[model samples]
Target chain A: MARRQAASAGTSANEAAPPPEKRRRVRIKPEERYREFVSKAVELFAEVGFDAGTRELAQRLDVTQPLLYRYFPSKGDLISAVYKEIYLDRWKPGWSGMIEDESEPLRTRLQHFYEDYTETIFTPEWLRIYMFAGLRGVDINARYVVNVETDLLMPMARAVRRELGLDPDAPIRPEEVELFWTLHGGIFYYGVRKVVYGFACPIGKEQMIANAVAAFLDGAASVMRGFAAEDASAPTAPSTRRRSPGSRR
Target chain B: MARRQAASAGTSANEAAPPPEKRRRVRIKPEERYREFVSKAVELFAEVGFDAGTRELAQRLDVTQPLLYRYFPSKGDLISAVYKEIYLDRWKPGWSGMIEDESEPLRTRLQHFYEDYTETIFTPEWLRIYMFAGLRGVDINARYVVNVETDLLMPMARAVRRELGLDPDAPIRPEEVELFWTLHGGIFYYGVRKVVYGFACPIGKEQMIANAVAAFLDGAASVMRGFAAEDASAPTAPSTRRRSPGSRR
Candidate 1:
């Protein structure tokens, strides 16, 4: 009886209420709204890291909490979307082809590849968020590092050997990868100095990339041969040195 | 009247209260307590970053808020102390002399220097806290970078030129410093890989350091000469390239 009375009273109140005003609210498509939410989420997470609350995200997006959740079911889902957008989506498919293209000199190919790669990656959002995620012990960085090692660093190591007319079939050694890492890590550290530490790199991007390429190329062959000689002389080297992939030869 | 009544009541209650039990707590010296706070602060900052709270730090230390404040004055002071403990105090007074020591080969010196340096710095606390602070836009990284460049990198660049029979007094170009940075940054990234990203560096530290030293020495002369040629050939080069310190020569 009480529920019925309350419903009846509420209905009477609604009937007696004044008519709402006509408003000029813009209607957005669902697709547009979803894209907007994602872009805004990237900005938010990039600024505050993974701990950014949905309430703050909603506030930034000018959307309701339910609407934000409607787009992304959970924080983990949203972060996955972010990783895909920033890392996977921005990754150019042609990079591997560029690195392996036999027509171009290896130095030229590497310079072009890193110029393109750094352009894609050396932003505040990508750099800071990566460090943040890595520090947080998130596996995304580990996964990305593996991808880089398998696809980029290892292939480049082979390319160095081929360019130097060394036995291209020789197994990749851990030291070879470390040499390549010096080049890659040095380049990445330039970005870290600029973006993370806010220090000026002093050289323009093209010139810095050129310097790193030249330096790596100048030394890579010797480093590889040095490692081979070391491996040959060591009585127990094969058992001790960790092998890179395709080490069976 | 109300305040007086409450004060009298509190005094009466205290007078009527039973004697407190004798406690057996270990008394720590003030200096010891201060050291304990800084060590814990380093661990806390390394794990959770700069946003970690004093309340939590106090709880972790098993001390009162006032006690922490007495030792640290503020969060910034505690962090400064931590920075001093980790970076400044741990920096060896012998390193500059070691690098400048003409008695030993540059490679041998670098290997020894890095072995000693990594021993001092390759901790989870040192590595993670560095990344955290760098990402936080703290100037400590910038300060440290400058210190490294001045006390270590620039000197190493000069040493490289000296070893390679290049004009020992020739002005260190930006490219020379950058070449050395590749070596330094490469070694640092090894620590980052192991400590921060939890990736295994397959080679033993001694061998890896030796590889890096050999690789850097192999190309340092050519890279330096290549820059000299580039500088000589460019019509408008003097204005374009960034000059490192002592570029006036």
Candidate 2:
């Protein structure tokens, strides 16, 4: 038959397909494997919240518990590693990258930043740790907090200045940054309170996200305009979702 | 001598302020005692959060464990009662007082609403229970979340219409009430997040609170203005907290 003839032409039927080449042609580096482990931990954190089982976490990774022990010595170490690799590393770099993109206008970039902030913080894995650190008696205010220079606030300020063509040394004042965060907080806190207290949020989730972005830009723009002593003289009311083509530079 | 003379004229110095005259003020309605017990629970909820000792709660209240049990069957019940009283009763009512003040612009009233949202949700008792509910695995998506009606969204919409004096039903929609919750959410979540997982927040607590509020108002105004589609525009950029002069109205 045709099948027999094809098999005979390719290789002997009794001979196996050379045992899948005995090994991977491209090997996984230790860094890659370690990243894989931490990535799995993110899902585990979401599943059980911050203080759930490490043994279960290891089980989820398809490795024996001792094998996990080989990489991490303590629960604290594992959690800290999870915080560093999965949450901080993933978000911080992306934030800086967006801010550094000089081609995009400040308003658009700000919208992009809000999109990132809302998405990253609200997602289950990060949100789990975000909520857990407080009540569990963790000291989020220690030297570790001060060391976090890469936070969104500073990056945001830098981006604002960069957009305005200000010198690097001439970043916006700390008060301006503070103002931005304060307004930013109202929306953020509302979303959070709903989550923690188990309130069925009435609004559509998509609108909520879009509003967070749009409102943030509006407020921050107000702040920046106020900085220059520019008054928004209104013959006008503003729209929530649609931007005016005339307002764009 | 003069300071001591006033007390000696009417009462002994040793008399502890005559305990507010033991006459009961209100009728003993159903759940009155339950309400009193919950008031104490709110005090405790504010102090140690929801999960600490019931025996300690009894000791603090100077009652027997059995007596405490007679009023409420369990600690969770006591905690739930506190939530029902504090969060449930006044959420809608607070707006009724503010929105009816027709002299003020809707935007000013909206700002006032945001401020009250912060005070109510961020305080000790409510914040503690809010967390407890989350930790206890209460469903956030439950229908009973907050239990306020869609009527709340109406005031702002009406305010926007009257301020610009638009048609009762304009072609373009006014701001959705959904924006308000999202605005509240983004701010509240940061507070909880700071407590729960300070590791993820790049900014300090004080700064986060301030910035988050600014973000909320900015977002709210932005969404509102965007939706209103006003021919004239409010200054979008403000670098400082410029108090709205009309907020005094």
Candidate 3:
């Protein structure tokens, strides 16, 4: 599987250190060093799979294993730290400046989210870490995936609720979220299976994303349609006008 | 990860052949020994993983590893045979038979098909083997997942197109099939993730599936609305459908 091979290839590809030219006068901070080391370790562990060797990590870092533990406490701690640094930190709005567009609809903004997410948030390292997390089962990896996936949905949900004027916490049914995640999951898996694992999906990435977006729009519209259908019996959401079901469906 | 642990645990749990009544003998033609071995191997592999030890296989069969391989030349040969035996003959029908009722709407029938697919195809051994296939980056695992996922969608797509009186391969600017797979990816990943690395998904399986279905419906509806609006005004789906007007804030 290219994803499995990608587990290792992407590791060194995304080394934690600043490039040589940029580092000429840079003095790295202690916590920053720890984050870098931890992120690197996460990449390595994810790449190497669960039984990541400390010795290999040291070799990768070009530092002694003893020095490695000083920042984090143990191999387990380092793995956990990397898990948080890369995957956990990934869910938050890293591109705050990017998502601040006020005029665009949530659906429009989501396209950008998908782009950045596919590029930065859902990289091979992220997936590799995820694979290990799944393997570790009750370990930090699983916790990390669940937590990140949850957080990944948060910003989008907030955006949709804001734009659509729907319930933010109003018992958003499971299927509602499933639709969102399904588009997300299909894109993610198809990407991995294609780019990472080198599988042939019948469609290209643009088509895949279009399909996902279509599905998401369709799914979101249904909720409104269903809500509007209910509203005929009990009118609510007076802010927006409802078209006839025949007109909509 | 629970998926990984479950794989290991699943094997350990079935370390022994079933007791007297459990191993009920069925008459088999001598010509079908290969077939019989393949079925048994699939159950074992899915229950455990592709990397499952020969020792375990022997244990499950109440035979020694050497004796088990007599039918096949080597471990590789045996597993390959097992894969073909079970998947080639059986996997295509994962949930094919579950949705014979044509009266059901596309959404309901799709959900029904998914639920049945989950029950029949996602056997414990299937999880183990598939997960192992992913981790090892095995070609077969990746191939089967994409193939099976696509195959599962065939019935759903045909049903939808038939309802709309659209051609099976009609180019109606990418209909609900994309939405189906997009949502499917999410649900499948969540379930696969759960099985591989145990997690109490915030919602139950049924709820999760429902959520996905809703999303797909909503998204597809949105796309359809867009399609109808476009088709009404123009002969082709507007190029703008491919690109959201702009990104969300």
Which candidate number would show the highest TM-score if scored against the true structure? 1
Provide the TM-score of chain A alone for each candidate, in the order shown: 0.80, 0.56, 0.63
lDDT of 3 at B113: 70
How well is each residue in B5-101 modelled by candidate 2, as lDDT tens digits? 5433555567577445563344444476566667887777655556556777765655545656777777667766776776676455666558546
DockQ of each: 0.22, 0.16, 0.29
Which residue ranges in model 2 land beyond 4 Å of their true spot? A1-89, A117-119, A141-150, A161-171, A186-211, A228-249, B1-40, B43-50, B62-67, B89-92, B115-117, B139-153, B167-175, B186-249
Residue lDDT tens for model 3, A1-249: 111344334447565643344322345688887867876787776566656677788768766567776786666677667766665576655544344355675555666657777776446677766765665454665665555445555545545666576665553433344445666677777666664455655555555665576466646665544543445565555433333221212
Q: Which ten residues in a row have the lowest lDDT in candidate 2 chain B?
A: B240-249
TM-score to true structure, per model: 0.82, 0.60, 0.65
Native-referenced DockQ of model 3: 0.29
Model 1 agreement with the true structure over A1-249: per-residue lDDT tens digits:
011244233445545554354544566898999889888888888877777788889868766667777777777788878877787887787877788788988877898899899998899888877887788887777788777776888889878778877665666777777767777888888888888799976676677777667766776667776566666666364545653221221
- The C-alpha lDDT values of all candidates are 0.76, 0.53, 0.59
Q: lDDT order of candidates, best first?
A: 1, 3, 2
Cα misplacement distance, residue A237 of candidate 2 (Å): 36
Distance (Å) between predicted and true CA of A121, model 1?
1.2
* C-alpha-based local distance difference test score of model 3: 0.59
> Which digits, one per residue and each the tens of the lDDT, describe model 1 over residues B209-235?
776777667766677776666665663
Model 3: CA > 4 A from native: A1-48, A51-85, A89-103, A169-179, A202-207, A224-249, B1-52, B55-72, B92-103, B171-178, B202-204, B221-249
